[model samples]
Target: MSASQALGGPSRCGWVLGPSLDKIIKNVAWRKHSQLVAACKSALDKLDSVVDDPVDPASCTPLYGLSTSDTDFVLQPLIMALDSASPKVVEPALDCSFRLFSLGLIRCEIDTPTPTPSPSPSPNPSSHSHIFRLIDSVCKCGALGDEAIELAVLRVLLSAIRSPYVLVRGDCLVHIVRSCYNVYLGGMNGTNQICAKSVLAQMMIIVFTRVEENSMMVDFKTVSVAELLEFTDRNLNEGSSIQIAQNFLNEIVDVKSKEGIAESKLCLQLEYDNSEKKGEPIDGEPGEGADLSGYSKIREDGFMLFKNLCKLSMKFSSQEHGDDNILLRGKVLSLELLKVIMDNAGPIWRSNERSSVVKSVDTSVNLDNKEDAASDDLCISKPRRSTRIVIPPKRLDSYLWAGRKSREQGKS
Candidate 1:
């Protein structure tokens, strides 16, 4: 008889732990074991047939009347295989994530349908949280076939911005900002790419817009300062971590204030244009500049926005440790931003360095305000450059600081 008939119907884990099924499950486990490698390689062929569409009603036609938890039960093991390092495991994992994302099962997927709410109170709970988490892990893998992971990550960030519920929506925007700070400050353990100044500028523009939307609807009493600080302490170390939280808070405040948001947006757009025109060959400044006020402002704004997020989570009316809650956002964004700052900052910083020095050199030489030949000779005229790239906010500074830090890393 089949195992289901013989063993008192299908057990919760499905399939009996006999030699054949055990062999199947054991082979797919991701643990780095020398002994099981060859067997797992062969079992990969069966992954699609077994677990590819556990949630798809058409695929599992026999279980049309099955409960949601049962459907998840059948699919969870398949995804668990995704966490494994085996090539076989990664393929199915990525496949599942991609499929889930496409099906509107991920936050990025559902987020598109959600329009920006007015400065109003509204709620829209996603039908499924597992899908969100699954998509999240897949996007975090740092690599994807053909498509860049950054684009995938960006889509996720954008989705959060578009969510309808105040707490949930703010949570998403908060993450984008956290990523921004990570990119700006060198906190991501040298894993992320630093953006071009142009990218950074555009990011600020996006963030400034969202902060205003979120700030208007916020119930500031949701999470208190003490609880937020505790949460921050539990999840993040000081260094760039706490600082990122602070920047987010400031950005929210800036966005809410018409005068503040407007000025920052214009300046951000200008900087973005300049960076794009400058291109990818930023070599480095000849001498250290006296100030870091610009970078600091971005950080401070980021922290403030994040602080408010923390407040919301702790004090939410029915909050019960929703992982997607704003207070939990810092960790997610922190790690994401850290990766960008590590990868993209150096070349960008170098490209701008020469220009900054040349400008300084020109200013110093032309004390008489003459269109002098010497200063003119020193400053080579270059054509204006334009790139269509728009960076998400806080992301720019996160990487910029990383680039600068990497430059000085040798000295330290």
Candidate 2:
């Protein structure tokens, strides 16, 4: 049994531990390739199984039981396997590479034992370039592999776009977007072009919705966003690009509106009850509290996006020759204009609401412990918690704001 199995973890019957595996990898030549490939898969499988503890969170302990030197010994052989001409060796190897890459564990940190003295070429490739080649292989898999392989490749590709390393994320986006446009330039593979466009749209939504300013900064220099926008503008009716853009815009507007309300609500009580429990004196008076206009930054950022989207709508509007395209463009244009007007009007409306609600009320008028007593006699009684007010009316302000903005823009 291997060390992993000795520790009561999963392992194959003939599993070899680190030193034996290392000897096999370093000594095995290309002439006797089957043993080398099988050994490589076994090492990867061991690492995979080490990470399969029910006790540990998924992908949380990627290096699990392996030391720095041992990890290098394991991964170096697998990188070598990528050069093999045999599909049998390449397929499983690629799958393992994708698994490790997706978990952000493909690159072993330099602190690991037997560190590379300097960067070297293929057969002794550096970690970064190796990962680049691995993902590149996955992208090319679609041409020869089935839909399952293609989608698995795309899924891993998308995860890379969300990587913590800014450069890595940026490069992944550039590859996908450029590949899509390159297909168009090559004037072949309509299916591949459609696949690329769809993935691009999904990727855009993920970035705009889930990412932060730092990630957005990384994308500013990349051609992906511009290429995707150009593709949409030129082939608006050819694929699902237009609908994707429209849906993305709607989601952004909806999400921004929700955040505005949640983050800028009226504070009913200035002093939180928890501070009183800890016997700490709170600073604020009965009414003076955090600014209700706290959502200014959010509004500003959202408005910038909304403005850019409206510009896109205008561009599409100019090219509308067909009745159907014109109708779709008009609907999107109307929503975009509405987004602008709503953003402008929000602060004014919020200011009025703030002023009206700023007046101080006697704290004593609120529900007290004495009010909960069943008997009239003044005795200690449990405090009744405040009843939450539920407003039943559906919020139609966002919809109305869009309509009003469209009308105003039309008049202007």
Candidate 3:
């Protein structure tokens, strides 16, 4: 009558109601019996009905139509197979979970509760535990050179990052960062390389915007930027390190403080409004300027973060041309940090400009210097495989003709 009996029993509901199946697997000494493994493999194939068509073309999940008991029956076996030692069982298990997660059948949980002693345990497994197990399976597959599995897992992780739950987003971010770090350390293979690039690009966009705007809401304290830099430094040689540091610095310069402040206000307002909609406090008094205080604090912290990053980069960038006494050398002791402050502290910088506190120089004099700096910046910023201008070689006759014309004109 239970889910497990349905799986091993001769009934249509066996595959549909199978959480009780875990009890049978637990009861049997399957670890010691070769026949039990074969039976599990066969049972898994049948229970994995949603592996191929979890969601229809319109992104509708047919699983929602199923009764709650039926959903539990289907998900339980897949969750169990995720931990199966056999790759055959694990593959379909992963496929089923990925499909269900992608189809929105299982919502990502914010908190994963630890199992404790209880009089009665529920047959249903926690979605949180399922997700963690799925991620574990993904890492194992990647280690075993299962490129396809890695890509599937990445898609699921990306979906989880968009969850409204902050904890879910943080967990997803950790998974992505770990994936990227692994790719960096192990050297990304073909399919996994593509998967990593796709994931990293999405992650960078999310992190950059989220950190720039709702710095308070999105928790990134768990992910250490310094640790990321160190990991990247280990994988990168001196030349590459200099280039990455230079490129990041150039990107920083291109970020405009005025636009950033405006964007921050918009994002903060949205966050406050959303919180209120969800019946949560706005963190401060609800008014036009409620978020202003938070925004200012975030701005200050952002400036400090950038200042620290630039200082850290200086240590790395020095390796490129230590003897040349680079740009940081002999400069106003605190000028670099000052520039960062000015760039981010729009009010102070704008006030100084208005009061003529900062001197202006002729544009033409700095034109050559600007061009050189632009070129250097481009070396780091632009894609290496960019379109280039190709000039044709001038023929000797063209030069001679021009010389003869000049002589004739002068004589005339």
Candidate 4:
């Protein structure tokens, strides 16, 4: 019988293998499912200690263990029910699989034939597709799970970022970017290393560029104006001469309050309003929705940061302000900081004005698909959630040297 049929759903595990492994869910009670997990884990264990090197591909293979037939059976049921599975069992199991694949305990035999039409169709179009599925699913699960599961995933994540394969590394980086982005966008607070305080500070600096520029073309008309700004402005220009003026503006409008709100909430509110409006049904142009449709507002507010500094400069320029060189220098620095924000954030002073560089980032699928430069080892450079860990180079050399020394000493 086919693996899917033999191992389809709860029946196979419940009636066939439950007596031995003893993981029948009772309430959800997937018997054959547990057996499948065990079988998958056993196969994965067999691949442990396999070597991975481009010059010696066999070094990374017990290729016979993870054939196409095996992963198909394993992935199907688990994914279909992942969202519904009890967190206690499923999260840990998925974590184990993720770590197994990352550690090379689970050997995979991929048939990456040349791009040609063949008489028999392949079950999977590409060898790397399953690896993608595993990473995607586990991250999705991690996104939904509690602290423990997410932390477990982070550990496995730190491992996958070290993978040798281009596709795997790229996929892991995308996950890392997404995961970090979600934490920030999700309104998470405190010093979580996975997201990190310093990184958030850095990202806020990165975000000061307008959504169009930072998103590099992803189009934030899909996002809100407030969110776009909050995600970007991370307390830039902290200790310059504009303190009184920035404070006055802050007092006038609580700019920081919006930053505290999560994008998910904003997105939901807009969704609710859309739903209510739809129920009545009378609108034109969809009201431009929540995103900022024009540059005037951002320019107006951002230039407010410059206004006080500009006043100070005007005083300096007119020689009204004495050679209290520190004051003059502070004014110059404040204006410089404001200009940086404006250039990066992308708001036009006049409709006819042109920026030398377009503020749009190339947030294209194509960009993520390409391999990331070695930002660190194992970076595929995709913009998902990712992490980094230090591994000693010549790792396998240490293993080989120790093994060889042991054999020689024994012979002596």
lDDT of 4: 0.33
- The sequence of per-residue lDDT tens digits that candidate 3 reaches over residues 24-90 is 3454456654454455545544554433232421111223333334344454455455445445545
TM-scores for all predictions:
0.28, 0.36, 0.37, 0.33
lDDT per residue for candidate 4 within 29-138, as digits (tens), equals 34645654555444333223222233632222221123444445444434433444456555544554444444333332222233577565433444345545555666
What TM-score does structure 2 among the candidates reach?
A: 0.36
Lowest-scoring 10 consecutive residues by lDDT in candidate 1?
378-387
Which structure is stronger by TM-score: 3 or 4? 3
lDDT tens per residue, model 1, 1-412:
3444422123211222112223435456445543344433433323222322345322212112224444344444434544444544444445434333222222211211235543531122232334344444443443332223433343333333322111122233344444444333332322222221112333433333333232312222111222233322233343454344344233322322111233223333333223212112221224333232323222223334433332332233122443433323433333222223223232322244432422322222211212332222111112232111112223333333344356457437
Error of 4 at 36 (Å): 7.5
**Compared to the true structure, candidate 4 yields what TM-score?**
0.33
RMSD, one per candidate, in order: 21.2, 20.7, 17.6, 24.4
Give the top-scoring candidate (TM-score).
Answer: 3
Clashes of each: 50, 4, 3, 29
Model 2, 332-405: lDDT tens digits are: 33332333233233222224433221111111112232333221111111122121211111122223333444
Error of 1 at 182 (Å): 4.3
Q: In model 4, what lDDT does residue 241 have?
A: 16
Where does candidate 1 stray beyond 4 Å? Answer: 1-71, 74-82, 85-132, 135-412
